[model samples]
Target: MKSSIKRYLIGRPLKSNELGEQKLNKTKALAILSSDALSSVAYGPEQILLVLVTIGAAAFWYSIPIAVGVLVLLLALILSYRQIIYAYPQGGGAYVVSKENLGVNYGLVAGGSLLVDYILTVAVSVSAGTDAITSAFPSLHSHNILIAVLFVLFITTLNLRGVTESASILAYPVYLFVIALFIMIGAGMYKIFTGQVTEALHSPIGTPVAGISLFLLLRAFASGSSALTGVEAISNAIPNFKDPAPKNAAKTLAAMGTLLAILFSGIVLLAYYYGISPNEQETVVSQIAESVFGRNAVYYFIQFTTALILVLAANTGYSAFPLLAVNLAKDKFIPRMFTIRGDRLGYSNGIITLGFASILLIIMFKGHTESLIPLYAVGVFIPFTLSQTGMILKWLREKPAGWRVKLAINATGAAISFIVSLMFFLTKFTQVWPVLVFLPLTILLFHRIKRHYEAVGDQLRIASCEAATPIEGNVMIVPVAGITHVVENSINYAKSLNADQIIAVYVAFDREEEKKFAEKWAKWQPDVRLVTLHSQYRSIIQPLTKFVDIVEHKSKEMNYRVTVVIPQFIPKEGWHNILHNQSSFLIRAFLLYRRDVIVTTVPYHLKK
Candidate 1:
């Protein structure tokens, strides 16, 4: 049954040696790891435009300068994370760097922040993708959340199948989205050169507000910083790359950063000149494409690829979140279940948790991409700031060959990231407040989990146990249903435990039944003492509990460990299980909960 499920869920199980074969190359790695950043160009320009459009048309010009600023911030973070890739090639970039340089508490903060961000990335990206579809066909609007959830489930399934395969599957759409964006940019540039975009720009322009405050522009920059959210993911998952992992990862980072910058800047230019504004009906990218292509097939192509890439952007979280969770699990910050790989050697537990969380967010927000966007960028920036600061501290203390130069770069990166984080916090305070609650709570959870693992380790310390001496005595008790072959088999298995004393217990609700059992037992001559349990309440478990308590107390004085061997009924067919009382399960529940008692169930297969 288990093997059937494994094959069905993840195909064949991969051998440990196949680990290297699954490592992703530069192009595929770029597609899988950078999907989040690359896909963000779809709505990132619009996010900035959202704030600008709110204060009216004159405030709209702030987008180009904010785009420039966002590009600069993106460069800083990219360069910062490249340092992270080389300095900590084993991947655990944020948590490891912070713990190594800053402190454990700081690392916990970064870890918690990154965990939240990865979850939010899945939620926001999937929600935005669904929004793209509903925009295309308004009749599908009611099904957006359902579609978003299904998308997450599909992505989770792909990731569980394997990292390389997920990347290979998603690479085409990512590249197509990139190509479509460039085509739109090219078309926009042609219109710009011909001075023909003036009319397009005028249509979507709103009434100018009285003034554009500096605070508003800074807020625009903060909104635009959403594009930089996934930049650090490569550093956190560098080990998943092929040989010369660091070099390949660093090159992928460089390529992703350059492409993101160009796309972001070009989309901002197109948004401004084409006069696209935030609307409930369509995205700014859709507006830009329509302006550039005039409802042509190319326009639909761009929109289709845009929607696909947005949905698939959750691939980044799939690639990085499980790796992050595994790092945390290794350090005893989360449950060990997160450390167990699926048949494809992926962190299956983490992937499932991420998918569930993303779906919850989608349902909670009702698939409104606008509702999720503000909360999305805040979680991402916290880790970005923490990781960059951690790197600066690393350079300052290490003083490597190019320590001074690296220190200055990381310092600038850290400063910019910290400022952006502050802006996000102050600007998106209401929408992002849940993370304020979630981050501290998550840190508390990490510490609590660590303490729990520590306590378990201490209790199970084999070094502290006395060895060389065999267990001196064993008291085996068999709870019997009646005079049956199954009871005889239970006694035989108990004899194998080499018990110094074996007692067969029978619970009887009637005196006549007890006498008949004793007569049958005497004739059978079972090689064990028989104890009859009288139950006034006519309950099997009640009489069994009393007998167990008395035996457990007596054995304590004799220095004998108790082993309760019960005859467990095994139904031959699935439907046959419903016909059984399942009393052995009831007894196992009572016995295994005690500290010093051991319960073993010997399965008695039934012919029926």
Candidate 2:
């Protein structure tokens, strides 16, 4: 029944051979992988204006220069990541580049930073989408949190349905957003060219709260840099492309970068010409739409598509984060569960985890895009800086053809990215300090997880057992909860092992219960010996495990092996499981770590 429900929700289980067929073509890949970068136009300019607006109208002039700076950085990243795609086509992105060229610590830092940034991408993107919705219908303002969470859940469900399907579902909305913005930009341009509207270069309005300083400009630049957050995703997800993955991925990266540059420049340019400023009540894009189309159908179309692409922007995170987790898991830096594909051939664990984390961020910040923006850029730039630096070292060490040219591009990217990372840390220190603290702690966590997996591998190494010969005798101990068919089957199974001795161990909390069980055993006349243990504290697992340890020691001294067969009943209904005691489960859990102990469960399925 559960399987049927799951199949209905995520579609039928995909076969392993169907994986190749699931790879995305360029159009679908661009829509799925570039949505985050493309949708940043909705809020990126506003983030800059939000900072500059504090100094009144005169400060708005800085938005253009800062946006240009961000564009320059964006170009450098596109060129650099194209190199990354061709060089590391296997696509671990920054983690792989940094590890191979810059060493493991740098690699882990890049991986940890990218992981945090991906979560922030979903949260900030969805929150911005919610802002777009509220801008269109102010009555929905109070429900932004609910709206944002629902968007996350919806996108997560689509992604869990697998990549190609989600891409097909999401591609049209992204194109709609692009078309709507271009129309709005063209309409605004037409007005300007036709002398219908003049440049908004009015004098300062009201008092300037803060003077324009280098710090203010840096703050604005850092804020605008959020637009570049998802550029690396194309490189990170190169393997998701169809055959000729790297070449196809590079072309897609160029296409996405081109679209992003045009849209971002158009929006920022039009906002400047229209004298748009950031406001709490409406987004800069919304204001631009209204300026061009005045709350008409076109304006609402802009808002609707903006909300969609913004929400679906999180699809980029869903695509890349799980793939990153698979890489990290393969290195044993995280749980191996992330490396396992779901029935739909997607990394279901990573997708669901990204969903929940994004929702938590939405709730914590109350679905305000502005509040989440400060935490977004720093996480992204750290990885950007590291990845570019890694590429530089790779070019230097390998010195392939055109190495100097490639080196120059990546060096420019590294320098610009590093500067941006530092500026964000310094300017947004108060809001971004937690991220500063999180990066090192996350690296430390990676180290700890790596150490644990290494230790487990060493302990379970099969090569270490080559010299150890098998013993002649064995002792089978069965922990019985009651005189039921479960115990009967467990004992019968244990007897099949041909052990020299069999003990049916029972733990009784009361003297009367022990006596009653002993008489019942005597009446059954089982050939196996019954060992009744009295637990004064009513602790069944501890007593049973301790007895097993003693038996294991005795068997070791006699050159025999010890196996504990636990009898566990299988309830026909999952909900009925709560009605039964789980002593067999407890005993197995307690004995699992004992080096010489072999614990097995014999299940007796109940029909009703």
Residue pairs in clash, model 1: none
User: Which candidate should be chosen as best, given TM-score against the real structure?
Assistant: 2
Task: Please give the lDDT score for candidate 1.
Answer: 0.85
lDDT of 2 by residue, 44-142 (tens): 888888888888767776677788898899899999999999898999999999999999999999999889889999999999998899989999999
Positional deviation of 96 in candidate 2, in angstroms? 1.7
Best candidate (score: lDDT): 2
Q: What TM-score, over all chains together, does every model reach?
A: 0.94, 0.95
What is the Cα-based TM-score of model 1? Answer: 0.94
Query: Worst 10-residue stretch by lDDT in candidate 1?
Result: 200-209
Model 1 misplaced regions, further than 4 Å: 199-209, 465-470, 508-519, 534-539, 574-581
Q: What is the C-alpha lDDT of each candidate?
A: 0.85, 0.89
Off by over 4 Å in 2: 198-210, 465-469
